[model samples]
Target: MEKEEYLDLYYQMVLIRRVEEAAAQLYQQGKIGGFLHLYIGQEAVSTGLISARQPQDRVITAYRDHGVAINCGIPAKKVMAELLGKTTGVSKGKGGSMHMADVSKNFWGGHAIVGAHLPLAAGLALGDQYLENDAITICMFGDGATNIGYFHEALNLSKVWNLPVLWVCENNRYGMGTAVERASAVSEIRQKAEGYCIPNDCVDGMDVLKVRQAAEEAIRFVRQNNSPFFLEIETYRFRGHSMGDPERYRKPEEVKKWEENDPIGIYRNHLIAKQIASEEELDLLDEKATKETAEAVQFAETSPEPPPEALFEHVYADVS
Candidate 1:
């Protein structure tokens, strides 16, 4: 990647991180509500993968979705307002934190149900293939969802039907406090794909370049073969599973150990070592991101709440 490309990727990651941090603060302050899941440490996975997609391509994921929406070009203020249940929200205040969708950009949603989105993504791929549009559907999920039967079913069908989709598992060690080791028969998530004859690989989710490279290769393979592929991105989440948990499931040292591989820090060092950017330039980017987040909060704060009468709209179709 060129220096400019690296800088853009860094900027996107910073934007996601800052937007999520601001969302956490809003939830704490009672401005945002209803099952808030912060994507503090998993920004690289979404940012890198989404960067490789075309505008017409679609993205669907599990509940930890703020980063995906932001990376896919949803305005920060709109997302914040959606979380706050305000009229100006992305889903018009109906979807909250887990159901952000911007169809104009082909960002399907932030589905909350564990593995429900997988089949929906497969259907999306089918649509693309039927229409002969070379677009791909990127389905992302957590390690916890890997154990669910829907994932396997979706993969098998997509592979057999030669659907253009990439099943990306963000293996963040724990699935709402239950570690993958405790939840699954075998801890190696990618290896599970061999049974279905789907091509599979693992990538370091924390490293943006690695994630990008892996996604690019998978996307290319899917385009060439018009088949499904599987990727397990081993990542970590720094914050508690949600706003409610005390997070007593893991030891502090474990969290610290993962922090040692902080994606942001690693990428920053790589840029500097490669002479792509200097510390000062990165700091400026941080400052800019902080400011942008602050502005989004202000916008959400001032935005009007949805009108009570609007509740009847966008529901059942009008029958004349």
Candidate 2:
């Protein structure tokens, strides 16, 4: 990637971090409600993988999805508005934090249920293949989702039919307060694909370049073979599973250890060390992202709420 590309990636990561921070604050202030999941430490994974996708490709994921939506080209103002439950939000405020979607951007809805979107992603890939389109479906989920029945079922059918999809497991070590060891028989998520015969690999989710490289390779494999692929991105989440989480599952020291690998900070240093950008330039980018996040909050604050009568509009499709 060129210096300009690196800078853009840095800008996006910074913007996402700021936006998630702001969302957490808003949730505390009662400005946003209903399951505020912050993507504080997982910014690089979303930015890298989403940046690797074509415009025609479709993306889906479980909750903890604000970064995914933003990286997939949803505007900060709209995403924040969605979190704030304003009519101007990406889903017109009906979806809130866990259900934001922008079909025009090809971001399929963010699923609140664990591992439920796996089959949906397969359906999308099947549709794409049926239509003879070259578009692939990227389904992202957390490590917790791996143990679920849908996870295995989707992978099985994806292999059986040779669907074009990428199953990305963002393994953040814990699945809603329970450690991976306590929940799964096999802790290595990529190894779960062995029975299904899907090509699989693991990537460092904290490093944007590594994540992008791995994503590109998986994407290429899917495109070339028109088959499914799986990637387990080993990462950590700085925040709790949700806003009100007691967080008794992990120690502060463990979090601190992972914080040392802070993705944005590490990438910023890389840029400066390689002469891709100056510290001053990076500082300016941070300032810009902060300003944009503030503006998004203001927009969400000023935007109108959805009308009660509008509730039924998207509830059902007209079969006629």
Candidate 3:
């Protein structure tokens, strides 16, 4: 990657952190309604993963998706608006935190259901296959989703038909309150991919560079082979599962230990060590992210709410 690209990546990671921090504050203040899942620690996963994808590659993620929406090219202003339930939101204030989407950007909406979106992801890949398009579908889900029957069904079908699907499992240690060891038959998520005969790999999700490399390779494999590839990225959600979560299951020390490996900090240190960017330049980016986030919040605060008459708008899919 170029020096500018590395710098931009840093900016994006910082922006995500800053925007989400503000969102958390707003949620606490009762300005932002519904379940607000902040992608505080796992910014590196979507930042690096999506950065490696082409425009045609489809991206679909789970409920914790503010970071993914931004990486998918939805402006932070729109993201904030959606969080505040403003009319200018990406989902026109309809989807809220868990349902941001821009079909033009190929970022299929984030699904609120645990494993329900897996089959939808398969359908997306199938559409591309039917149209004879080379584009691949990148479906991201939590480690918890894999435990459901939909996960197995989607994987089995993807391999059987040789669908171009890249299944990315963001294993953040715990699925809600349950740990992977307690819920899953196998601790390592990649092992499950083997059962479906899909090529699989694991990566350190805390580091953007490592995740990017793995994603590039996985995307290449899926695109070239027209087959499914599973990637289990070892990530951790620094915040609670959702804003309403009491977070009694994990200890404070454990959260602090993972906080030490904060993705933005890791990438920032890497840029300085590699001489890709100077401290002053990076600091400017941090200031810029803060300013951007502040402006987004301001915009969201002032943005109009969806009218009551438009309540039924886009509630149902238009097959025609």
Candidate 4:
């Protein structure tokens, strides 16, 4: 990869971190509403995975989707606007934090219901197959979603029909407040894929390059075989489940330990070690991300709210 590509990845990860940090502040100030889930520690998973996708490939994921939307090319300004319910938002202020989608980018949505989007992903892959397009669908969800019945049905049909889909499980070790081992029948999420006979692998989600490599291989396998591939990305979310979460389930020491493996720090060290970038160059990128995040917040704060009539606009399709 060129130095430019490495830096772009670094910038994006930084941007996501900065944006989510600003979002957390906004949520506290009541500038944003609904459930606010920050992609603080798990930035590398979406950044690397989406970076590996072809534009024709569709991406759909669970409600924890701000990072996913940014990865799919939704600008930080638009994402922030959506959070503030501004009309300029990607979903035109209708979807809020959990429903941002831009079909033009082939990003399906931010589904609020747990595990509901899995079947939707299968449907998307089937569409690509029907059109005979060399496209695929990438479905992302949490470890908790794997416990849902939809997870089982979707994986089964995807395998049986050989749908071109990548089922990415961002196993952050928890489903909301419950630890994976406490709730899931099998702690290793890929085993569920095994039940459905889908090809699967697990990788470190904290490292961006490793994720990108694994994703390239997994994506290549799906594209070549025209079948579903499951990836259990081992990750941890440093923040609480939501802005309002009391977070009594875990220890502070555990979070500090994971924080030692911070994705941004890891990638920054990698770039320096590989002679891909200098400390000064990376520092500039960090400052740039912070500025961009501030500008996005300003844009969202100044953007207009949806007009009163907008409530009736996207609620139903206008067939006429």
Q: How close is candidate 4 to the true structure, as a TM-score?
A: 0.99
**What TM-score does each of the candidates earn?**
0.97, 0.98, 0.98, 0.99
Model 3, 1-320: lDDT tens per residue?
Answer: 88888987888999999999999999999999989988999999999999999999999999999999999998999999999999999999999999999998999988999999999999999999999987999999999999999999999999999999999999999999898999999999899999988989999999999999999999999999999999999999999988888889999999999999999999999999988899999999999999999999999999999999779777679855
How well does candidate 2 match the true structure in TM-score terms?
0.98
Which ranges in model 4 have alpha carbons more than 4 Å from their true place?
none
State which candidate has the highest lDDT: 4
**Model 3 residue 23 lDDT?**
98
As for model 2, its CA RMSD to the true structure in angstroms is: 1.0
Per-residue CA lDDT of model 1 for 71-102, tens digit only, reads 88988888888888888989999999999998
Point out the worst 10-residue segment of candidate 1 by lDDT.
Answer: 311-320
State the local distance difference test value for candidate 1. Answer: 0.89
Question: lDDT for every model?
Answer: 0.89, 0.94, 0.94, 0.95
Candidate 2 lowest-lDDT run of ten: 311-320
List residue ranges in candidate 2 displaced over 4 A: none
Task: Compose the digit string of candidate 2's lDDT tens values, residues 1-320.
Answer: 88888998999999999999999889889998879888999999989998999999999999888999999999999999999899999999889999999999999979999999999999999999999999999999999999999999999999999999999999999999999999999999898998899989999999999999999999999988999999999899999999988889999999999999999999998998989899999999999999999999999999999999888777778755
Which pairs clash (backbone N, Cα, C closer than 3 Å) in model 1?
87-306
How many residue pairs clash (N, CA or C atoms closer than 3 angstroms) in each of the candidate models, in the order given?
1, 0, 0, 0
Of 2 and 4, the candidate ranking higher by lDDT: 4
By TM-score, the candidates rank as 4, 2, 3, 1
